[model samples]
Target: MSRICKPYAAIRTFLLLLCGWVPLLTALGAAGQTRIYDIRYGNNAIGTLETKQETTGSTRRITLKSRVQMKLLSRMEVDIFAEYRHNVLHAAKATRLQGKSSADSKETSTEKSANGYTVIRKGERSILHHARITYCVSDLYFTEPREIRQVYSETLGVLLPLKLAADKRYELTMPDGKRSYYRYEKGKLKEVEISHALGKAFFTAREGA
Candidate 1:
């Protein structure tokens, strides 16, 4: 996967929780907010990600869209939509397209059930029980900055330990030995730093954009 795809994968998994699990935590105010971010690899402007959230009655919806142009020939795009009702995820959908002509594409859809959550990807079905699942991608402390010791990663589909520093930053080490750092300000995610073998990639919020 490309560097841009890594964060999108994680975000896609978290959208599942946002659609289904965020309501269980706290109620967001009626006001809606949107943020635009620039994804950079070293000094190159590679892509942009736009995130928006809105609330109506007891339902909350979040949408994210990103497009990246890599090198001179390859391009990738991702779109995610999530909906929640009374703190329970109602439905969510994500689609990813790669290549100049979008020759390769994959999509995943999730729905909440009375028993648990159902996820469909590439024609495979899986049941995720609330009890069996200990954490979610939301626990990374981006939206929820409360103290958390571990997080469930939807990309890797596994539980990983998280280290929180005194400055309110959270760090996680990927399976491939790469480390990613997350920072938030005023309870909103501000930046993400991803370190890979090549170098560090920074995703920073573009204020007023």
Candidate 2:
């Protein structure tokens, strides 16, 4: 009877350990997954964007890479990296490369401090209060579908207010009163329509990719 009980108890402990680790493994797998999107403008394929997130314990990192060509003349590329702890962003960096040669590039970095944040762009420095920062080039709605009323723009260096619709659409009104709309389908972002001085441009995510 003692021998049988010993084996049973060992098996029970193993089972408990397996059960405890299953969810953690699944969460790690999900964090490592990547999503790619093809950007288009007026029936023409412009570029592609890839986004991924990594998590280790309570720390998370999100990265975005995008490359786009403009009318066969010059190409532009952008890379953004963001780090978060417990869902709050603590650091971020963005780099932009312009022209076909990629020689004309600019980099911007930000770090959070006890009081606020420090930003350095193209050798210029600035300080920000305790504000949440967001990148205008990246599609943040894809990762966080929650209704975000306002977001801080790292590029523009200001906080922008957004309007939300019942259909899971987000509208950002520019300082000049121009409006940009982000439409989602079934909680996933599908399209972004922008009305600006250049014209109305649409960015639709490729389906089944």
Candidate 3:
């Protein structure tokens, strides 16, 4: 992979998490919903993002998968799975892979603890001593943040501040200073514009979906 594409692994992970891309009707079930969104660069289609949510009794499980090929040069893929109980995060894992055959990989994991949660990344361990993680990045795909002010980023293993614009749009500023905008229509995510390491991209809802 080129040095330029190498730095994008982190940024792409964040962008994929922030945007919900799929142009299909939601498949509802007794346990959860499955949705997909299309990832684009300008007018060019580049990738897809899929999210699945399931519930069992009091536990809720969410999984997100994304694949992107930028300029036909490098490809990056990320998958995240999280479980929450009673609106509190219990455990989560996120994996990122880069290259044509997915030769390079990195992982971050979180687990509930007595106080807060334990985070492990690249084999190093850390601790987050906050209370409970009620809302996370994954929830953005399924629900609009009307009254939410903050959310936990499972990829970054940190809490990110979320703002509601006067236009009813949601805005998020990453730690690296990149900004992303999300718009919803009929309580569903319709569009997301994001600034990333490779410039700007968008995830828009597919028409007739």
Question: Which candidate ranks first by TM-score, i.e. highest?
Answer: 3
Ranking by TM-score: 3, 1, 2
The best candidate in terms of lDDT: 3
TM per candidate comes to 0.75, 0.73, 0.84
Tens-digit lDDT string for candidate 2 (119-138) = 88778998888654433324
Q: In model 2, where is the ten-residue run with the lowest total lDDT?
A: 13-22
lDDT of 1 by residue, 55-152 (tens): 78877776777777756436677776767676555666777777745548777776677667677777688876653343344323226446656554
* Clashes in predicted model 1: 3
Span of ten consecutive residues with least summed lDDT in model 1? 12-21
Better model by TM-score: candidate 2 vs candidate 3: 3
lDDT of 3 by residue, 1-209 (tens): 56556435544746544322111122123256777889877567878888787777667788888888877466778899888776578888888888756548878888999978999877889999998787887778877776778888877788888898788789987887767788998878788877655566777777643
Error of 1 at 187 (Å): 2.1
| Regions of candidate 2 where Cα sits further than 4 Å from its true position | 1-30, 100-103, 131-139, 166-168, 175-177
TM-score (C-alpha, index-matched) for candidate 3: 0.84
